[model samples]
Structures are given as C-alpha cells and as structure tokens.
Target: MNSRRATIADVAREAGVSPSTASVVFSGKTPVSDATRARVLDAAAALGYTGPDPLAASLRRGRSGIVGVLQRGPLGIAFTDPVQRTTMDGLADAVASVDASLLLLRPVPGGPAGDSGTAPGPATGAATLATVPLDAAVLIGTIPEAAADVAALRARGVPVVVIEGDAGEGVPRIGLDNHDAERCLAEHVRRLGHTDVAIVTLRSELNVTHDRLGGARDVFPDAPAFATLASSIDEGLRVGRQVFAAGRPTAVLAQSDLLAAGVIRAAEEAGLSVPGDVSVAGFDGVPVDGLAPYELTTMVQPAVEKGRAAGAAVVAMLLGEQPASVTFTSVFRAGNTTGPVPESRGVSPR
Candidate 1:
C-alpha cells in the first residue's frame, strides 16, 4: 500500500470491481448494484479511505464547491448577536441538506475596511476572501461597499445574495419589512394615546453613526425624538436614564429590546414606574438581558426564517434558478410595557 492517501483506483481494486463502478458508487452520478455498493463500502472501510478528497474533486470539476459568506467585523462578534447566529444556523441547515459548505469570511486585516490589501498568509483575513476562488458568495448583513466587489464577482459570473442589506445593482436581497415593523410599533404607540414619546434607537448604519434617536425621524416623521446609540442594554440604560432625568415622555419606543430593558432599568433607578410613569416598547422581540417582569411590547420578526430564506436563495442561485426575494412581517405583541396615557395627560399631548 502506498504511504500516500488512497485514491479511487485503490478503492475499485480493493472492492474487486471496475474503477468506473467504484466511481459511480461514490459520485452517485450513476447507479450501481447494491452488492457492488456494499463491497465498495467494505473496501473503503478496510482501506481507511474517506472516499475521494473533496478538494481534489472540486479542483477536477473546476469549482471550489464552497459558498463564501462575506460578513463584516470579527467572526466571534458576528456569531454572538442572537439574530445573526440564528440566521447563520438557518443558513447552515439549508445548505447541509445538500451537503454544501459554509465559509465565513471576515474583514481582511488591512485588506479593505481596516485591514491592508497585502496578503500575509493563507489565513490573513480579507486576503483569504479576496483571493479565494468560490462558486458563489453570500454578502452577509448588506456590505455597503459591495457594489464594486460584487461587480467584480459578477464579472467572474458568480451569483451573489445579500442578507439584511441593500443588494446593490443585480444582487438579490433577503430582509424583513424593517420599515413596516417600525410603522407597526409607531401605530401601536399612537393608539395608546401617547404623542410625546421619546425613542432609544440603534445606529441606522455602521459607517454613518454610533447611535440614533431622532435620526430615525428621517425614516419615521411621526416618531418622537430618538437618542441614537449602539444597540445594547447599556446604551438603552443610558438613554433611559437621560429621558427619565429630563422629564421622560409618556411612552418610549426603543429600537431593540436590549435598549428597552435598559430604559426599564433607568426608570427603576429614577424611581419612575413602568406603565405608571412611562411605558416602553422595543423591537426584535427576542428575550435577552434577563427581561421577564416587564413583558415588552414588541414586533416579533422571524429572524431564523430570514436566515433560512437567505440560505435557500444561495442554493437556488447555485442551481442556476432565479430565486425570488423574501420579505416577512413582524407580529405586534402588546405586553405590559405599553398602556394608555395617564389621566393628567389623558389626551395625546403632541
């Protein structure tokens, strides 16, 4: 036996069958007899052969057989966000059924955004993504500057799919009805007879701002003055503290539950009662930050479904099929966080 890895010829010889038969058994591109299949399996087991090397096979097919997921920032942080993780999981599940691989590409170090363009090594961040030859690429989380890169990829004729961001010119988009979800929350607040509502908002875009409260007014004019900040419970807490300190509104609609929870904490710190002095609502309806006592009034978007759709779109594009774009609506869940305005201001005091 050669010290080198077992090849298809070796498996065929061990199985006492023709090389083509063994190839058919492995590739499943052609059918073979059950007896032949059993023999091939037995031979592969005896020879400690894990079938043909995928890399070699991919090279032979003139394809990488891997889907590159271009994501911004550190891999760890991207996976930490519940929504992100769930979407990735859904994507993996969608690809796993067809035995496709998911390759996570982070910002290349000094490569483009922050990293340099020079290649350091095989694993040198963005260089790995830039140089890697892939069948297709999924721009995860809407790469703003992806138009050029996507155009380059398009030049190579690779199909691109975007998740939760603008897909640029020809790339397909997968996202929820963010504007509608916000409108739903706004309408809910409006119906509660609260007009002078303040907002704690997440940064609208990564490059543009750090936090946003009123800036969302660009998107929602009916919305109240918002405090723009990073989407986190701490940011929420800070915004909540300020609102409470500066004579808070009757009800506050936070961009995320993490922020809303922080607002609740701020309210507690200020000796203000929730729904008693100020009511609050949030987005992304997922339960985080140990929030239990105050059931948040939120819009529950199907985050996992969003991810699954993106993954499915990738699969479809790979198959040379036109996949349709998907948009999901968030269900408005009214909870303890929202109620009617106080008698002192029984009418909406806008």
Candidate 2:
C-alpha cells in the first residue's frame, strides 16, 4: 500500500498467507507447512521479491549483528604485516565459525582535511568508524587522534578490543611482546660481541614520522644505529649504501628479514659477504622471499595463533564474558644471518 515497490505485504497478499508466514518463508524462523512455504516462495518469485529488508529485520531485532573493525593503515598493509594478517585470519575464522561478520571501518580522523567529521564522508568510516551502530568494535591498530571516536564507542556501551596496539582505557588488549622481542634481538647481536650495530625499522604508529629506531635508541641509547623507515628490504638497501659509503659494522641487526635480505644484497653489492664481511640479523621468523640457502637469525612469532586467540577472546566478549588481555611470545630462530663478529674489521662505520 505504501507505494514504492513490492514488499513482504504484497507477497503475502498474492500467496493468500499472513504477513508473518511470508516472513517465515524467507527467514525460516518458524516452521511453515511445505506446501505453504512453496506457495509463498512462488508468489515471491512472481513479485520479484528478493527477501525481507535486512535493515528492517535488524531494527526489529535491535541489533546490527556486525562487529566494527578499525584499522590505522591501508588494508594492503594488513597483508604485509604477518602478525596483522594472522590475527585477522583468526578473527575471520572465529566469526565464520560462529556465523557472524566483521564490518571494516577506517576513520580518517581529520575529516578528510583534519576538519573532524565536517565534510562529506563514506558511510563506513565516516559514521560507523566514528559513531555508527555496532554490537562491538575492534580497533585493529591504535589511533591516538581518534580519541573522540573511542570515547563515543565507550559512551554507547559498545565493547572494544585492541589488537597489537592500545585503545585508551577500559578496553581489552591483545598485544605482542614488542619490547621483549626487540630486546631479544638486541641481546642476540650484543652477545655476539657486536656493539657497533645499525637498525632498519618500521613505522612506529599512524603518524609515520616517529622514527622507530629513535624510539629504540631511547630504550638502548648506547646501541650504534642507522635507521630507516622503509620496509626491511628498503631499510637494508639504504643502510647498505650507508655501510658502503661510511664503513662496515661488525654486525647489523635489522628490524626485519625483508630488511636483512636487503642488507645482504647491499653487502654483496659492496663486495662484502654476509657472516664473512658483516654478520646480519633480522626480526620476524617467517621465511625470506628470495633467500634460497641462507636462514635468518630472527624472532618468530606465532602470528596466526595470536589472531585465533584474539578472535576467541572477541567471541567470549560477545557472550558477556569478562574482558581480559592476552600476550604472545616470540621464539628466536638461530639462522645463517648472524655469527661471531669478524675478527678483522677494516674500519668501524662512523
């Protein structure tokens, strides 16, 4: 009667069934006689009725049935970051196993130009990322600038969980032992009699300008350093050039294997060899892409398992379980990248 297009009412009228019966044919919530269901479905097919409007059903149920997921970086970065990818996979597995879904919401906190939600924005992040309705929200990474959004979610009584980063207070946290992991790598290089070590680093946070190596320096001030913001490979190559231009390090402990591999490449380019001219080490225990024969001395974290744990935690939270925290450990892998500092160092890189 409310003229727009065919609705459940129209289908019910055509099938000579009550509106509730028509809904049952679509949702299968209540049992309908087979013959009656067939009649309702056939009438629906005739009227080109797809099904009940999900919005309407959601409103009726008083739940959106969606979990909002917030990320600080592009989705592609999620794939590249082994930890994030594994965690997401775990979350997805849990959601699927439970017949639930996750809705991605990336909030550009500056309102496209740092305006704070004034300009036109996409439906997902604009509203949902900031104040959209959700049963719960998982801040995939920390967004310090989006503090208001975090506060809003809390005000709405939506449970929040953070993976790999913090989301203010009163929210559940799932984190890796980043400090310990870095310390472990540092200790490995230090124990090898190499005090003159340079580091290749990753972005510290969403700001992207905060030097990861600088932070490391604050923690390990005496550690010699050449830091880069590029991926492990890029950092390796950049630092490798510096090595060739400035001088050689007794050992180089890169932040990641991708960077370590780049260091190896640069070492070879500079007519130096790994473990021969310079002992190299890296983080993330995952295998290198083109490093065929050489194994990297790095810390390996159970990425997928961490994700699964986070997902399970989310499930527990959804079931009204008390919020808790989880931390995963990193296993050090003895590989070909590191060895005793070469007895003969021509000159230390100043």
Candidate 3:
C-alpha cells in the first residue's frame, strides 16, 4: 500500500468497476447494484479510503455546501432559547434536503483591520458573514446590527433570508404575524378582565418584541413594559422582579414562554399565586424544562416551520428561483397560568 491518500479511482480499480460506478455508490444520486456497492465498500476499506472529499466536490460544483445561520447574540445564548433551537432544527432539516450544512456566524466588529481584505481567522476575531464561506445566510433575529450584516452578505452575492425581522427590500423574510397574534392574545387577556397589565419583552431591539409590545399596548395602551437583555429565564427573572417590585399589574404578558416562567417564579416569591393574584400569558409555545406544574398560556407559533421556510427559501435562491416571502400565524393555547382576573383586584371587570 502507498503512503499517499487513496482516491475514488483507487477504490474503483481495486473493486474492478468504473470510477463513475464507484462514485455513484458514494454520491447516492444514482443508484448502484447492491453487489457492486459491497465490492466498492470492501475496496475502500482495504485502501483506507474513507469517503469523498467534500471540499473538492464542492469546488467542482461551485458551491461551499455551507449555509450561515447568523445568531442575534452569542452562540451559547442562542442554544438556550427553545424557540431558537426548534427553528434551527427545522432549518437543519431543510438545508439537509439540499445537502448543505449550517455555519453559525456571530456579529463582530468591522472587517479585518488590515490591507489584506481577507477576513481574520476565527481565533483572532469573530467570523463575519463577509469572511465566511456561506452560499446563503439566515438572519435569526432582528438585531440592531442586522442591516450591516445583510449588506455585507448581499455585497458578496450571497442570498439572505430573514426570520422574524425586516432586512430591507429584496430580502425574502419568513415572518410571524407577531402583531396580530399578540393582539389576539391581548384581547383574550382583556376579555378575562385584565386591565392593569405589564409586559415582559425579550429585547428592546428585536422586531418581534416591538410587534408584541405594540399588540399588548393596543389593548392596554398604558401597560408598563419592561425589556430584558436576553431571552433567558434569568433575564426574565431579573425583569420580573423589577416589574413586580412596585404596584404590580393584575396580569403580565411575557414575550416568550421562558420569560413567562420566570415571571411566574417571581410572582411566587412575591407571595402571589399565578392566575390568582396575577394572570400570566406568554408568546412562543416552547416547553420550559422546569415549568412542569404550570402549563403556560401562550400563542403557539410554528417555530420549526418558520425555520423550514427560511431554509427552503435559501435553497430556492441558491437555485436561482424566486421564492415568495412567508408569513406564519400563531395558535392561542389556554393554560392554567391565565384565568379571569381576580375579583379582589380594584380594577372592574370588562
């Protein structure tokens, strides 16, 4: 055996088959006979030929076979959000259909600081969409810096798909009916007779937050709104404490389930029972790990479907097909967390 790496040709020669036949066994694009595939596998094992070189194959096809998923914040934080995880799962399935992998790209400072014009290595600096080899990019959330990220990717001729955010004209968006869905939820709360309501938001900069806030306000125009830095339960707890510290409302409308769970915790700590002292409603129907006892009242958005839509759009754009933008609606779910406003509260029932 030679010290050099084995190629498909080596396997073909050893298996007594044409190179194309040997390649077909690996590609799976064209079917090969079971007997011939077995021979090729045996030959590959004997020659220590693992499989095809993805880089070389991608080069031949003029594609990197990589799609960048731009996270609104740190990768660790993104994974903590159930909605993000569910959406990514759907995105993964969609991208896998097209045989592409996802590369997480985080926002960083301006391009590499030198004359080279090449993106700095990941170790030296955060990877920007400009520096990464992405055939297309999916903007996960509406961060304040999203405009610049979209511009950079578009400048490089990469297709962009936005999930729950606006990336300007020409960028196809997979959006949720945040305003309408949230308004529906708010109306439910209002009918339940919750006039004094407080809103807990994910982040101030997110478009989803803005839409949800707008919806809640549409019902309770003067509702006190508190913004959290992240979508984590801890952030929710932090904001929940503040909102509940002084003259807490009869109900709290949290932007995400995690936030609602945190608010529930805070309410308990403040010696208030959920739906007894303060009714809580949340958006995003994701399950919280520790929130077992209380089934959260929330608007169940199709998070995974949202991701699939974005992934499909990416594939379509890559293939030069013009895919239309997608808008998804949320289903209202009734849970024990929300109920008719406590009669003891001074506010009169509508």
Clash counts for all predictions = 16, 6, 0
Tell me the TM-score of model 1: 0.78
lDDT of 2 at 124: 33
Is 1 or 2 the stronger prediction by lDDT? 1
lDDT of 3 by residue, 61-163 (tens): 8999999987755687557778888899999999997789998877554444322123555466556677777889888766655767777778899998999
lDDT value for model 1: 0.73
Q: Report lDDT per candidate.
A: 0.73, 0.70, 0.86
Q: Which should have the higher lDDT, number 1 or number 3?
A: 3
lDDT of 3 at 269: 86
Question: Which lDDT value does model 2 have at 197?
Answer: 69
Query: lDDT: which candidate is best?
Result: 3
- Tens-place lDDT per residue, model 1, 1-350, is 46988888889999999989998898899988899999999998888888789888887877677777877656764566666677788888887755677887755554443332113343434344456777777776544555555765676777788886776766778867666677677777777777777777666554212223333343446654555446678888887888877775888878777788899999889887888878888888887857777899988878788778877887888788988877777788988988888868668634
